[model samples]
Target: GAGVSQSPSNKVTEKGKDVELRCDPISGHTALYWYRQSLGQGLEFLIYFQGNSAPDKSGLPSDRFSAERTGGSVSTLTIQRTQQEDSAVYLCASSFLTASGNEQFFGPGTRLTVL
Candidate 1:
């Protein structure tokens, strides 16, 4: 089976421009997550989606950031009015949620550069 994958492994855009990053999770996985890793920083949780329930977006940095999952499979993270501070490696992970806990499989990440 294929693991999580993100598109445009590298993205370069001018400040104030918008960018869309895509992620495809493993089949039949019920939980998906988005994270960002800035230079010399730990992974930062951006959002989480599980089944048909509303997504947990508390981790989103600001109104400029948003995401959506379609058919419970593919997800897109949209960053509007990109900023230099928004430059980072955006990672996607998926997992099968179980009572005993689960491990998240991560993607290579989409490196975003804002200039």
Candidate 2:
């Protein structure tokens, strides 16, 4: 079994471009999470998906940010009309059954550079 994985480990785009980051969580894990780490800032929780439902989307930076998990395994985070400030590393994590304590396994992350 593989751990969490992300594609296009690094990306570079212009300020107004839209970007889609992908994450593949551990198989059979019921809980998936998305996080963003900006330069000089701590890791920020972006969203969470339990099965196919997202119960906590409050952490999305704005309406331009959205994510969805399909079939309880894979997820994609879309950032529309990206900005320079949006440059950051997007990380994904998954846990078995529930997302509690230190049980979550995190992906290496996708580094997005918005020029």
Candidate 3:
């Protein structure tokens, strides 16, 4: 009955480095999603994975962004060659179903800062 959790809660790194963020989805939720929200910006979808379906990565900002979900539960978002432009709050959400507008519960998020 635990909720989703993200690690570090804050990260700062030099530009052109790589960073990995972790997400722990709620148990029994079949759908998981990743999103990015910069300061004063709206949440933008990055990637999604549902039960036995192809992952959706269309919302990823660029080739530097990628993610994967394993065991239908936990997911990790890895950023290659981090840039200052990539600094943002990386949020993770999960839901019972894959329907659009589903009420997804979000984690506190890992705040990434690329300097």
Which candidate comes out best when scored by lDDT?
A: 2
lDDT of 3 by residue, 1-115 (tens): 6898998799999999999999998888899888999876688888888953546779988998888777887888899999998989999998998898789999999999999
Q: lDDT value for candidate 2?
A: 0.92
Q: Each candidate's lDDT (Cα)?
A: 0.90, 0.92, 0.88
- Looking at model 1, report the run of 10 residues with the lowest lDDT sum: 93-102
What is the lDDT for 52 in model 2?
94
Model 1 Cα lDDT, one tens digit per residue, 9-93: 9999999999999999999988888999997777899998896453579989999999998898899999999999999999999
* Model 2: ten consecutive residues of lowest lDDT: 94-103
lDDT score, residue 55, model 3?
63
How well does model 3 score by local distance difference test? 0.88
Report model 1's TM-score to 2 decimal places: 0.93
Every model's TM-score: 0.93, 0.95, 0.92
